[model samples]
Target: MSSGPTGQPSLVRTGAKAGLAFAGSAIKGGLLGLILGGGVFFFYLGQLKGPGNTAARAGGAGAILALVTSPPLLVAVLLLLFVVVYAMLGVQRGRTKAMQHLVAARGEAVSERLAGAIAGRIEAMPRTHGTLQRAADWLSVDALSKQLAPVLGEGKAVRSVVGFVLNRLPMSDMLAEWQEGRAAHGAPVAAEGAAQDPALRALLTRRINETLQEMSTPSRKPLYIALGAHAVLLGVGLWLVN
Candidate 1:
């Protein structure tokens, strides 16, 4: 919502737009349900009624519709829909929250491992153009683990930090340069620190708020596919009941 004199009007307009959008979405969902329900009944009712019972086919059709659209069945379908939607949408949120927990619980260890793995590699790269990807690779491989094992030791903890660096948060390259008080662009360090003042921890925590904001959100295709699968399963159950 915007502020100032036009705020009230803008808010009203926004609310109206949201209402319309929701209504349109509901209509589409209803239409899709009707179409799927009709298709399922058409395919199954014929086999259920049999050929000699053609006279009662129409009646059986009605009975099937009534059964499938009953309050209990409808409620089940709606609940399943909600579950599928939530599962699809909540995956990213859950993954991010878990990552947050990992960082909080093991920040120091992970940062030290990360710095051990990639810091020397980045610093030894002759300040090339592809310093970033190389830094990521160094963190990814295990061969470099030996380089810093004497100090930081080696363990499964490195995997956790590497995944975060390459996938969730991207600060691998900066840690090395920060330690040396320089950057790939040949810029000298300005202030030379963060709150904790350790290079690895600084790089890990620095811009973390902003980097997390850039985490990729799951797309809608999987959501649609999940909903379709749920609808099919519900159809199968209804068929069994009939």
Candidate 2:
């Protein structure tokens, strides 16, 4: 894996990008839902005014308040739920793309022995409990472990190796730098200190690339199914209301 001195592929960076994309989708969907729901509410309110003065007879303000607080708000909330589900699916798709890009950047796989050796070296280094244990735990690689368990089998050793890479090693700094570069063009680059440590850099890059490749696969099918179900429920609700 030949990352530039300043630019390394990182799961953290990929995740950040996915999160931002989801946020944008959510904001757009929410605004659209608000507009549509408001329009429906007003149209119904106007129609109600014409027929038998039903709204006025029912204590005008109370009827209007009830209408505003009920159907329109409910629709808006349902639409928001739909939007969140779709946006989550979009994030999954974005993650797959980001993984593919990272895998392509690496071009070839680094050997398992080499990766293991680097991991072992990092684990042997002295470090604070907070930095090593807690920091590794923070990466939430256990989520990855859960996903991969059926394929890779369950083991404490696997978890340890993951923790070593994520917490004990210098990969976090490289990942941080990658995130900075993504946030701004021509950002101040990370120093060449990591680049100088070829073994560490190569191992970190391989782990990140391999992890991305694995995650990019068909494991996200469940998310798509859930999103579809949410959309269907929203559609059914709207139809019933209409």
Candidate 3:
């Protein structure tokens, strides 16, 4: 939504576009799933129930029906499987694309928030490209954990995030740089030098750990559908055998 001069929020077309994309994908996905699943069923049925014996003149039509049905079943199963696999792949790809958007949005959010927090405390921290890159490499785990937290839950996310943050958040480097050069030339010896500021580092470490402990969780829709499909297939196969 965008704010107008009158202060009322206006609906943007982004939501409409997203909705249409989702709907189209959903229809395509459904068709694919049905075809693939139905094909599997047809093939399995054909294989289990082979063409029955039919003598000339009396049951010729019956025998012909079985043969015709069996091959068609196989074809149906093939079609179904093809559709299902493709649909699933499409959905997964779509999800990844959507996530990229979210990642970009959230990344900006995190950066802006962090900048605000450090605005007054730090001075002339001249944005060196590789500095943050190196910091990110060092902070990979924490960064990943934080990124995953919203989707994966807070408890687990926090612990994972904190662990990485602790290992990556080198207070010594920050403190040493601060105490030695421009920022803190004669401010205070920075408790522990660049090579060893364990205390402040520990605080960040603790937070990551705590966050990991409170991690968020993933959805269970796929799991449930998978279990149901397996159960249905197993039951049907067993019934046919019996």
Best by lDDT: 1
lDDT of model 1 at residue 134?
A: 54
lDDT of 2 by residue, 16-115 (tens): 5645654564555455434544444444434332323445347668655654655533444455555455455555555455444434433243224324
What is the full ranking by TM-score, best candidate first? 2, 1, 3
**Cα error of candidate 2 at position 223, Å:** 5.1
**What lDDT does the true structure give each of the candidates?**
0.46, 0.46, 0.41
Q: Candidate 1 at residue 84, lDDT?
A: 35
- Model 3 ranges with Cα > 4 A deviation: 1-11, 50-93, 100-242
- Number of colliding residue pairs in each model: 0, 0, 23
Pitting candidate 1 against candidate 2, the one with the higher TM-score is 2
Ranking by lDDT: 1, 2, 3
Tell me the deviation in Å of residue 74 in model 2.
Answer: 1.3
In model 1, where do residues sit more than 4 Å from their true spots?
A: 1-79, 87-101, 127-134, 141-161, 169-201, 204-242
lDDT of 3: 0.41
Put down candidate 3 lDDT per residue, 1-242, tens digits, no spaces: 11233211111232234345545655666665666556555555554533341221134676456545554333433444544654674465444333333323233332332322222222223345434324333334444445544433334322433453345445455544444553444444332113333333343344433333322222345635654664465455545434
Total clashes, candidate 3? Answer: 23
Q: Write the per-residue lDDT of candidate 1 for residues 1-242, one digit (tens) a residue.
A: 22244444543453355345445544544554455544544444343433333333346676457446454344344534554354434444444444444444344444554554454454445454545555555455455445534433344433434544556654544555564665554654333121233454446444443443333232456547656776676666556446
Q: Give RMSD to native, each candidate.
A: 15.3, 15.2, 14.4
Candidate 1 vs 3: which has more lDDT: 1
